[model samples]
Target chain A: MKLKQLEGLLGNLDQFSAPKIELEQYPTGPHIASRMLYTAENSFEDVSDKVVADFGCGCGTLGIAAALLGADHVIGFDVDADSLEIAYLNAEDLELDVNFVQSDIRNLQCRGKIIDTVVMNPPFGTRNKGVDMDFLSVALKVASQAVYSLHKTTTREYVKKTALREYNAKSAEVLCELRYDVPKLYKFHKKKEVDIAVDLWRFVPTPTVESDV
Target chain B: MRLLTHNMLSSTIKGVSNGFPLTIEAAKVVEKQVDMNSDFLKNIFSKIEWKPFVEAAKTLGFSELPEEDVQPSLLDSHEFLTKFHHALLEIHLEEGALVCPETGRKFPVNKGIPNMLLLEDEV
Candidate 1:
């Protein structure tokens, strides 16, 4: 699909009706989401005909994008059941067959290298420290091909260091930086809207001996 | 959830070792047709645990998958690929529970999404 067309479809999907502070739920805008998936498919061939997963899939935006891009199978994982409900409705509206599971990303007990690619907009760890790292850690393990995620631009050095050294990733590269428009979803936000610079990262995991074992 | 998701998932409650291939309690099963891709099925064939996959398919009332482990060359067969595609992606557990093998704890599946979150104590 054309990038413009993909963005148009994602623009119509439902977002969080009630944002949760603890989970740091922020809707992934169509602009960033379309660019992320478009790059993954066009540049790296990670979406189409591959098993793609969306971690902490809020309202199923990224996963649905993968489905629209012709992913063979798409599974969305999220801890919030209410968000999953909205995600389910979103997929139904698009007439896309995406599977969803209600489980915390940290505690997900996925075995083997069943998934090819993982796309997510994880919590930036503002509420709970290191939660973003935790999501990256699991995504590295579950995905066999690559993991595409967004993190704060300020933490670029930290994210690269930890992903390579601690998570044992093969390679971590920042694809691009985009402005994350955070609307006033919570009372803590003093401004009507704030644009935070966030980096889109693509991390390739080191091949494991236990792959598909 | 589709069996593709089920095949990758395990019981994640703390202290439960080897909580794989969670038993299926199928209260309701639905089939949603999807376009078949032989290459995709072929790539995922080696990654799947065949016994559990066949067992799960039987539980969902489709017993066409070979019970024994088969060679990857079988993926070339159109009939086998069709069955594999249906069992893996088409059959949906609309309403059911996935019970952990170790603790027998039930994780409910509602609206086709499995709830695998554990209590704080379990975690």
Candidate 2:
């Protein structure tokens, strides 16, 4: 999609909700912050001949970006019907083909097929019950390479330990951070602060299958 | 199960602290073709956690990924999106256990599907 078109889409919204399965949604304006999109876009520059998946595809931003950035194919999954509707509209508008499925991230079923890359900005643990780790674990299981955005304060340690223990994946901290400034007038806005610190991780499966042995 | 589902699941037992990536010990796996919608994906980019998704794909034995910091072009061509769709939606773990790293909790998969059920003792 052209930058101009994207800008138009971004500008056309007054309030945008995240894909429904997530605990919360962005109150107004494009649900995603433009800066975050730019950051993610830049992050996938070298991806090629790879299948990419965008989990919790609120409005299909990441998947669209992946296609634009040269991913061989992109599939997006979300649980919200309304969000999926908007996501579909956005994909159509951009003239980029994407696969958007309506399903909970927890119970997703993709038989034997594998993708080269996966990307997501899962619910920040702080929003509801602080269980974002569940989202991270699943992402690790389905993609060869993955990128995750999380709260800067708590996610680093948790992500590190999980990556090491589960898939034996190695991680590197990217120097990028996203901060959202919420206007103070709202009841929940006691000066909202979201520190977006992302970790880039890669998994190399152990040669445990007997075929190699 | 899709990597997206694996990420949100936990051992659900009473005190399992880390249940992030449910390990798949699949006894049977299957794949299916699903429809595509590009506009929907474009709108939901921020909600994805890319790193773990990549890790999960690798575990399944796929290793082609773009480098970090590249811009995805929506208008590049149809060929690119078609290939991406196959990897992201078609891959399936028919049977497997999503083992938790912190608690050693195991969620089993039967018949190309993962059973994320937790026992009362686990909860």
Candidate 3:
């Protein structure tokens, strides 16, 4: 599907009814989401016909996008039950069969390399330090092909260094920087809207080499 | 949750080993027709654990999948692909619980979505 059409469909999906500050539940707007999934499919061929999982999927935006882009199967994982409900409705509204599971990304356990790509807009770890890395850590382990995620632009060095050294990523590269317009979802926001610069990253995990004993 | 998603899920409670292939406790199972993609079925067949997958299918009231061991050569048969596609993608556990093999913890499935969230103590 064309990028414009993809964005238009995602724009209609329901977002959070009551945003939870603790989980850093912020809606991933259609602009960045379209670009993220578009690049994954167009540039890298990491999306279509692949088993895609959306980690911390909020209202199923990214996973639904993958479905729209022809992903054979999509599974969305989120800890919040409410978010999963909205996500389920979004996928249903689009007539897309996307699976959703409610689980903390940190504790999620998968047996084999079934997931080909993981696309997520994780919490930036503003409230909980290192939580963003925690999400990346699991995404790296779960995804066999690549992980597409958004992180704070300022943490570019830290994100790359940790992914390569600690998370067993073969390569980590920032694709582009986009403006994340965060609306006043919580009382802590003094302004009506805050624009934060975020970098879209694609990290490739090191292939697990079989050994002869 | 579809059987495809169930194949990837396992219990991650504190120290439980052998948590894979969570047993299906089906109360309400629904099926939705989807286009069968032979290529996808061929690729995913290798990744699926046959015994548990067949068992889950039976619990969901789908007894078409072969009970015995399946070889990759079965992909050549369109009949086998149809059965595999239906069980993996079409069957949905609308209301059920995935019971952990080791700890016996039950993860409830509601509205076709599985709640795999562990309690704070379990985490």
lDDT of 1: 0.94
TM-score of each candidate structure, all chains considered together: 0.99, 0.52, 0.98
lDDT at B2 for candidate 3?
A: 90
Model 2 segments more than 4 A misplaced? A1-22, A27-46, A181-187, A191-213, B1-123
What TM-score would you report for chain A in candidate 1?
Answer: 0.98
Expressed as tens digits, the lDDT of each residue in B52-76 for candidate 3 is: 8999999899899987858999899
lDDT of 1 by residue, B1-123 (tens): 899989999987788778898999999999999999998998899899889999999999999898875999898889999999999999999998999999999999998999999899998
Clashing pairs in 1: none
DockQ of each: 0.79, 0.04, 0.64
The list of candidate 1 runs beyond 4 A from truth reads none
Write candidate 1's Cα lDDT for A1-213 as tens digits.
899999999999999999899999999999999999999999999999999999999899999999999999999999999899999999999899999999999998677889889999999999899999999999998899999999999999999999999999999999999999998999999999999999999999988887532
Please write out the lDDT profile of model 2 over residues A32-87, one tens digit for every residue: 33334444455544234456777777777666666655555666776565665676
Tens digits of per-residue lDDT, candidate 2, B44-82, equal: 233334565566666665545443542467325465455
Number of backbone collisions per candidate: 0, 101, 0
DockQ of model 2, rounded to 2 decimals:
0.04
Local accuracy of candidate 3 as per-residue lDDT tens digits, A37-123: 999999999988899999999889999999999999999999999999999999998889999999899998766788999999999
- The CAPRI quality class of candidate 2 comes to incorrect
> Ranking by TM-score, best first?
1, 3, 2
